[model samples]
Target: MQSPLRHGRAALGTTIATGALAALSQAPERASRLFRHRFPTVAVTGMTGVGKTRLADRLSRRASAEGTQDVGSAVMERRTRRDPRMRGYRFRVVPGENAATRLGALDEVFHDEPVDGVLHVVAYGHATPRRTAGTSGAGAATREEQLAAELEDWSITAHRIAGMAVRRDRPTWLVIAVTKADLFADDIDAAVDYYSPGSGSPFADKLDELRALAGGAKLSIDVLPVCAQGGGRKSSMPEKAATELLNRLELRLAQLSGHV
Candidate 1:
């Protein structure tokens, strides 16, 4: 019933409004891309039973609230996560049960995208047992033996990462996340010092080797203690420690991204 001029004006107005809405919807994404640094991709890696998956789940906002379930050997594929606190950053978890799978996961990550950093998780003699009954040498290893084996695994992983960095000719950041601090809550300082670089620990020696392998490639390394499941399983770490850990992690990620 409307006149042709009025109908045309109405149509034009509708078009203009829709275009404006579309632009407004896209503005956030555009602004993010413009102001944010390149997406920082980090790989969470360590020997099996070292709480890598749990730590990843705890940091990621998208992870289920029910908690992460245990996996056999290692996760079949790398799981990616994004923390709300770490905007424009991605954390990828790679399996590390054995040399083949560990190296393969790292290769897959490098092939898929350039990694900005790595979180090498360690438990400092409190990692869950990897073997069960009926397996040869199962339960025979003492805690000291287990820790030694894990340190050996760390050496291998570090060497592999250094090789990858040298090949890519890119600077890499490594954070040794000493997980399960709750187990040794009484002597947390000793636990941290044991893994700290230049502490004269075996782990420190391996870190020196990693640096040597990295050669001209810039490698920044840091050691941090974390209790991923604070308040769970009679955890000695208080909730405050968990909060502080997250804050420190956020600050470290920000620093790596040059946001600090």
Candidate 2:
């Protein structure tokens, strides 16, 4: 099925073209409530070297079903996007202790309210553990220890929120986002050339690296490939990918609630 965002957008364009704006205006919220009954929460998470922030930014706009502004490296602004379909439901994309506080704030904001769901964005700039001789290597004693550390971080976030507020019977999703696959892929290419010449190319080794870390997360996750840096520029395919993810999420809610 075509996404409501795309179809509705086309419908909206036709409505305006056919002078039906007056009709749509009378039923403004109708278009927004594509999945009104769902309290669906998605914790967009990944390692520190992944693209959490970018996914959050893109997904936020999809949640709101509106075009959002450009958010990239040149800027370090805190941002939020609220859903009109489910009023007071919003996604917070900022970092730090403020993120925890914002979660609680949203809980209070929607304390007595029904929700479509929650989307948690974790880790913006992160990478897989490189199998290096230095601090960034793969394995416990090598370079990528940071990646392991991040896995724990993501788990903590999951347990802290999903474990507490969500139910075991309910679907609590964790999107194990991998950012900078291009860079990682590139690095792999370089590595194969430098370290294991004639052994294998980096492209051949890319998925193996991704799989290793994701497996270590020990969490059932939707491993979404992402690239957040152009560092402060617009994403290539990620924005579209983000929209599709939101649609899947919407579908998940419907399946669970039988809203359809």
Best by TM-score: 1
Tens-digit lDDT track of model 1 for 158-204: 76687677877557888888888878888878888888778899988
Backbone clashes in model 2: 30
Superposed by TM-score, candidate 1 places the C-alpha of residue 165 at a distance from the truth, in angstroms, of 2.1
TM-scores of the models, in the order given: 0.74, 0.39
Candidate 2 local distance difference test against the native: 0.40
lDDT of 2 by residue, 147-220 (tens): 44554554444444433333233433334344444444334233323212133433213323433443423323
Cα deviation in Å at residue 104, candidate 2? 6.1
State the TM-score for model 1: 0.74
Residue-pair clashes per candidate: 0, 30
